[model samples]
Target: MTNDPLSPQSNDSQKRLMVALALSFAATAAYTFFFAPKPQPPGAEGADAGVVLAQGADAGTAEVAVPPPGNGGTAESTLTAEAPPPPLRKVDVARQEAKYTFSSEGAGLTFAELQGRKMREQQTLTIREGFDKLFGKPVPTAPQMNLAHPVPGQPLPLSISIEGNTPLPATTRYAVEEGTTPKGAGTLSFTGRQGPWEVTKSFLWPHEGFELVYTVTVRNTSAQPQSGELRVHYSRAIDPEFEHAPSFFGGVGNLSRSACWIDDKLHKLSPGDKPPEDTRGQVSFFGIDQQYFLSALYPLDGPMAGHCVLTATPTAREVAAGFPLNVGPGQTATFRFGGYLGPKDPDLLRTVPGVALRDAAGLSTAAAFHPKLEDTVDFGIWAVICKMLLAVMKFFHGLVGNWGVAIILLTVLVKLVLLPLTYRSMVSMEQVKKLQPRLEEIKKKFADDRERQNLETMKLYQEAKVNPLGGCLPMLIQMPVWIALFTSLRNSFDIYGEPFFGPVWTDLTYKDPTYILPLALGVSMIITQKMQPQMMDAQQAKMMTWVLPVIFTFTLLQYPAGLSLYIFTNNVLSIAQQYGLRKWLARKGGNPTGDGTAAVSAAGGKRK
Candidate 1:
């Protein structure tokens, strides 16, 4: 009313309401014309299965046209705002050891099946086959290992996603191009676009290795600028029924895990464990670590600041490497990545791209490649010892060409290294035997004074120039070597699937299917214990001799065959060494070798 009355202090309320209605109507009309759902054309109707560009994004930049894939690549239909699917297609690229299948839906790895002898799985032996193998019958090898077995649904390995102001889902499809690369390598390029960005994933798979060079390029297609984090995702589906979590006290667990090397350290998450909270740092590599085998991706240009998100469940393991980017109109940001999908072999993993790899993946001279992929093989707390033992075993293996023989040779090497210590310990034990009579008298003398008994025992030990605890030193020294060997068997791929004289001792990394090795180990352990001087009270001696052997056997029964084999071999050698030591002692006017209890009986007679 005031506006109608001009310059007065009032306006017309009805006029204002009409103006609001008109503005609302115009917005509704615009939305209907641009975004309202349209009817399906012909037979273009079905389940909304295939990936599509997110709604409300610019339709002009929705589809990146692709030429007909002439060089064995598939011709993919364009993804539209109204049209749902373009029919999923696939392409396969085979290297020497692994064959990778990429899906056009996500332009990512569907399955990475590893080939070769050692990579072959271990078959379940029947009772009849077990007996035949125990008697030295050869068994057929198991099937090849599939790095992407039980494939995860959607957002497959090496998929791309853009998160920020204009987000792009990983489900978006890409037009793929497949061709042969230089140096007999296989190549595959995936190109797609949504909203303001166009993305391309280029891969170079060498002819004969587990390495792959990958490059990701994202370009701003819209007139306006775009900014976000480019995420590269890797996922694997594991059936909990078949997979088990790793346990040091228990046997070797074969469950695959997710790992990321952020900053200076490596972070791993096994199935059903909590994910790392702080993962922002300079990332070196990340992927699914399946113990003996690995499928990982690392920045080809070296470590760079990035955010890595890790996830694990009873059924799946996932890792996403996110790199921040800001692209001006028409500008492109490209990121290079190096990938490894093969055995966690230190020789191969530790080696960067060399001259042989220069022409393999069209890599930038292969000199800029420095990915610390070897860390995937976690050596636990005994890394130093593990490395030393593994080095010696490798040297011996090179000489003998047999892993079992190498382990035996390693045992001998360790024994020889500690020869001086063992000799000193043996002499000390013999001297303690001479003082046993005096020790019993002292125990009876100070029967009620426990503190006085201890002081007198120490004084007697010092006077005799002997150490009563000397017998335990050799065993203590060898404990580290044993643990390192166990760690190698659990992780080091060099001995992961190797055979030990064939048959029941098929795989050293795996537990012995037959209980023969562990049982033999227990027998050898008992004989060795009986040969050593019993330094403890009657009850403790019984526990050490009987209870310890039974428990040790039961424990080794579930451990890797390599460990039990090492102990059994060491015990046999120890028995031989002790026999020789006793003969030497007899010659020196000490305990004789004939009566196993000669020294003990003589001491008892003297004490009486």
Candidate 2:
């Protein structure tokens, strides 16, 4: 009944108490050893909370690395995909002329949908629409061209990365900050961090034009130095629906290529062309160059030393340009770029982002960089003539407010410039018509002497005060104009989406969807050929009058409608001019000095 029943004996109680004390002491020692040290606020010594640190490269740049989580084991710097990424999204920054779409995953451009009356995609016509187009009804239009469409698995356009190092994955989720630019334009700033590296992309929409301004900053927060190629990428998944490779019978379709301006020279590569071994130089611009549209990047600091990497496949076109950089601990490197995503208009391309953009970007305007961005609209060998044609057409367009009328006026202006030469050519043909009988007689007399026949022909030509080659002067002069006009239509943005009288000629730079214009052109060409004096034999004349027209129609079926319009207008004008000249001569002195009908009557009257 005493406490001995509930409690142990004194010696036993002492032994049990000692054991209990030992166990309690052990538990206390373990808790103190494990919980005494606090985990520092990231980046301190002996911390274990799984915090990441990163080093980011630039657009088409070099390398980046992410330090390991937890301090116990110092793993090599690398990017790991084992962990789940944050939610991805898209952000749109719009202006008066365009809407730029960006992806939060890569903090790069997803696609840019341009907005402008003339910037819409080429119109597609149905039978009813075609009828309406033919009947002078209003033609319908398609949506605007959306450029920089990324391939499913490829890097987004304008994405930044290091050639060798990056902290966050290119597809890292970012925190976005939206604000207004100094010019009152909308701006989007994206920031992503991993390990000790952080990257930020700040994009500002321009008040007008297709040129956009963006700034990229890469920071290293680690206590160590970081170096890598900082690259900015521009890639496009060329939609076969929007692009067409140039065929023998096709106009210069949307032939997309990769282009770069380096060290004062421009280099372009098509899908199958071999790339150069070295792309390093003072790069001014680099991007994808479609015949009518351009998507490129020019440095806000003008031309800077960098290397360009180009990739062209049947389905994609890509360019990445960047330079090497070494960032010290707690320091940052910034890159500013001018993004051009619009028609390849020289006027627009010529004006790079200037002080306004710099000031809006929170950068100094002193010594602002100016790049020769207009060089992207290259007309190659026809540059001079093409520019002249474009200038004239633009002037006429401004005055007339219609591109079709401007083209006709341009043709008239061109014809007037060469009127003297064409008039002389017609006169030479008339004079040669007068000598045709003598030429035939000489040919008969020297049937066996080919050299003698040629001599007599030359003698007759001399007596008539006409060079035998004079009749070819008009053709010689017009050949360059024709080729230059074609090149202009293919390369110049002035006539890109301009339409003629109606839907039959929706896009002047594109082929006439209907065969009406080209076929009518063929008929007019036949009449013009017949109107010219018979300079060749019966076989050659027949071929020129009929077969030539057929071949020409087929060839032009795939050419720009604007070129055909010019030629058709020229032919009609020539006919009127020749008829007027013949009538004037008949009225002046009743002399048969006319060029077309009179010459034909006087020379080939015996055909019957």
Q: What are the Cα lDDT values of the candidates?
A: 0.78, 0.75
- Candidate 1: C-alpha RMSD to true structure equals 13.5
Strongest candidate by lDDT:
1
TM-scores for every predicted model: 0.80, 0.81
C-alpha-based local distance difference test score of model 2: 0.75
Worst 10 residues of 1 by lDDT: 66-75
Write model 2 residue lDDT over 15-58, tens digit each, in one string.
Answer: 88999999999999998989787656634534333334333332
- In terms of TM-score, the best-performing candidate is 2
lDDT tens digits, residue span 99-166, model 1? 78888777788888898888865455555676778887776666787777535464788888998988
Which residues of candidate 2, in runs, are more than 4 Å off?
Answer: 1-85, 124-132, 135-140, 165-169, 181-183, 275-278, 354-356, 362-366, 588-608
